[model samples]
Target: MQCVNYLFLVLILTPILSTFSAKILGLFLYPSRQHALLGTALFAELSAKGHEVTMISTFEQPMVQKKFRHVLVDGTQIRQKYSPSLMSLNVSMWEHIVFSNSEMKYMIAELLEDSSLREFLDAGEKYDVVVSELFAEALLGISHRVNATTVSFNPTGGSYELDYLSGNSHPYSYVPNAFTAYSDEMTFWQRFANTYVNLFCAFSKHFFNLPMQRSLLKYYFPDAPPLEDLMNSVELHLVNSYYLFETPRPYLPNVVQIGGFHLQKPELLTVELLKQLDELKNGIILFTVGSHRKLSDFPVQIVETLFASFSKSSHNVLVQYEGPPPSNLPANVRLMPWLPQRAVLSHPNTKLFITPGGRSSVVEAIYFAVPMVGLHAPGDDDSQLSMMANRGFGVCFRLDEELREEQLSGAIRNVVADPVYKRAIMLESELFKRQEMSPLDKAVYWVEHVAKHKGAKRVKSQPAAAMPLYKYVLLDVVVASAALLVMFAFISLWLCKQTYRVLIRRRQTEPVKHKIV
Candidate 1:
């Protein structure tokens, strides 16, 4: 009822509030396909709202509108510089962050030096707003270049770093980092590890990342403001996360939660695929590891175990296998190079989804009200899957576990046979769908508001991004308080000792008088 009233108010005011369309620049340099889709959605909505949009992205769309221009920036060149073979399942969190930072530094440098991008910068193209993805420090330069009101597009929702920068309360006492497999209710060791990792990354960014980003920004645009100034000047943030799937925490007014902004009504599945699903009365189970990790990368023994389990299962299995599938597969098992993932999940015959627990996948599955069996790997996958399990919508198994046929098959069987997973997911889906305004609507509204208002600085926390670590975390205040307490303690102890000595001296002086009497 409250949501209905809020949305009704928005609908009534939308026409009155919206007055003008302005020039917008959308810059997305991330190479991942998922991120590319998100970037596309943002620009598409802006174009739909009659704004003049210029987009620089890896997955470029030919301009559908006369006012929109698309520029293709080849991300593959940067990707090729670092071989994909360098990444493996065994990589640690610290190593991953360091390696990722190195790659981003080079990528940003390459992007800035690109002849076309350099020309764009020199062309003096003025934009009213600049919307750039928040992952890379290099992308922040675009906002500075255009002198536009900057809005950060974070595919992953607000993190501690962003929250800290924006002066939001992101307490290390409770909240866990994305890299660690810990929840808000963490064990002592988990909390210690989480704090250690956050502090380590924060320090590393200060000493290592900031200097490199600063140097690169200066090299590209010498007259631009300092890198920290550019970041702090951001007027708004569009984060791709929902509150239900996340730990409940406070966010800044400028930070908007726009998770599921890209989701659309499901597209129809192919006739052949639909037929395959129809034949299975027991229902279908979908398996995918997302875009980055191919099924071929798995060990032969692991594949054999999965195949055996699928062969024995009563359910029909649809696996997104990029390579040649097993030669002799079970009659019920099917493989495809690609499947419209959300569409397939929406099918009535679909029973369970088996995934590596990527954020987009988990959110989509929840959107469709499907139970999941997650294979937890290192990095964000572990943390996300653990969260899903804790929420009771799914169960998670560590990929590092020793494999057995029954373990895989039994888990699937339990998910299919159990009613709890189904009930929980359905309820969650209901809550997820009962939003006041669609994520896309909220995003479009906020974006246009910024363009019309010339920025959202009034709503943003003041100057927190440029604040030093000691001040931001109150380390200085803590040290000062400790020092004061120590001084007071020392003074009190000295007074007591002086009194004790005087009393002894008085008694000694009185002893001569008493003897005379």
Candidate 2:
């Protein structure tokens, strides 16, 4: 009877005790609200799953919950200091890269100088895992300081930098680099350009970006491990990429795609907004230049052109513009400082989405099965919108001074009139939805998996990451093969020359045989 009771108790406790709670620290200090949203959603889910999550970010959480702590940083000051002209699209890709590196350096210096963060660091707190965005690698030193497993996060689709950190293969022939506006199927010149851009970016990151970050890391965390070791110690990479929409690329075991993890169940729109949307006879068109940018950043002429185009459209327009409303604002166009983007997109009467091709906006549009007219702003938006255009789901155009009313209005009119664009996006939405596990669930599982095991050392590709550059590129093999071919060619030529010489010598040695010819 005693043995039986003990066995029953053990079985009961097995299921209950199997649940493990971990102390997690999330460092998402990037200034972008969209980036914060991704980090918040992830940490929120972890907190709900019984983990103690403390997040340091630039944005505030919508809802506060137990087991979750929020530490807010003043990202606006950093942005103003480093990137005064945040939304200028006139710069080239190289210029943008240089500017971003400088901004990240300034951001790191500011983050390290925070008094609260310094106190937290000195508190001797230990965490099982530290999740951080890959934008600022110096922040990964916090994980080392706290004695936590490092998990790097990418808010956009995976880049070559992430691939290198996670030891994932990046085939440049098919996989477009981060900056290019090209698809998988590329012409020779496109492939060449992709390879060139990838190399250039890699060179810049290593020689320019990493050194500055290392200097900052050394200055801030004198006793912490080196930045390279810290980066190599990152056991898992979680990317906001789904293969259905993003081009299919090879991923390593430690690299997980948790795209659309930020998406939540659509919330009910305000009653007044709902009534207005329902009253529109023709469908509605939603236009927003994403969260990070405002309409004021756009050229005055371009804004005027957009207004003119919106006025001519038959459908009602909802514009998320932060600038002052124009005196000539049309009756059909409504300008609000902010809009409930997800709710508006999920509405049945929403016909089209006109955006500046931010990743979050594009993903949301795809989720809601709304066709888009992409006025691509600078940065990766050009490539993102170009991919959408190539896939036949949207039409992409440069958001610049040259944009005219006809071009803007015509693209919107065509996408709205044609059912093909809608059908394409709907198919994409279905494919994106057809996943065995939700992206958020997968992300949480992996975070827990790392915490449960203490680290993901067993799953990491050690050999691939440790391999030398020449070996990784197979240059040695190519050189050896070329040498062997050259040797064989030389031997063949020597044999032929000897044979010809022998024939000539034999004829010279033979008696009087030339007259027969």
Model 1, C-alpha of 131: deviation from truth (Å): 1.8
Which residue pairs overlap in candidate 2's backbone?
Answer: none
Q: Write the per-residue lDDT of candidate 2 for residues 398-443, one digit (tens) a residue.
A: 8788788898889889999999999999999998888889999999
Candidate 2: list runs displaced more than 4 Å.
1-14, 83-86, 476-517
TM-score of each: 0.88, 0.90
Please write out the lDDT profile of model 1 over residues 95-212, one tens digit for every residue: 7778655666777778777777777888988899888886666577777778788888887765755775566767877888877767789888988998898888787777877787
TM-score of 1: 0.88
- The candidate scoring highest on lDDT is 2
RMSD of 2: 3.8
Backbone N/Cα/C clashes per model: 0, 0
Which regions of candidate 1 are displaced past 4 Å? 1-18, 62-67, 80-87, 264-282, 490-517
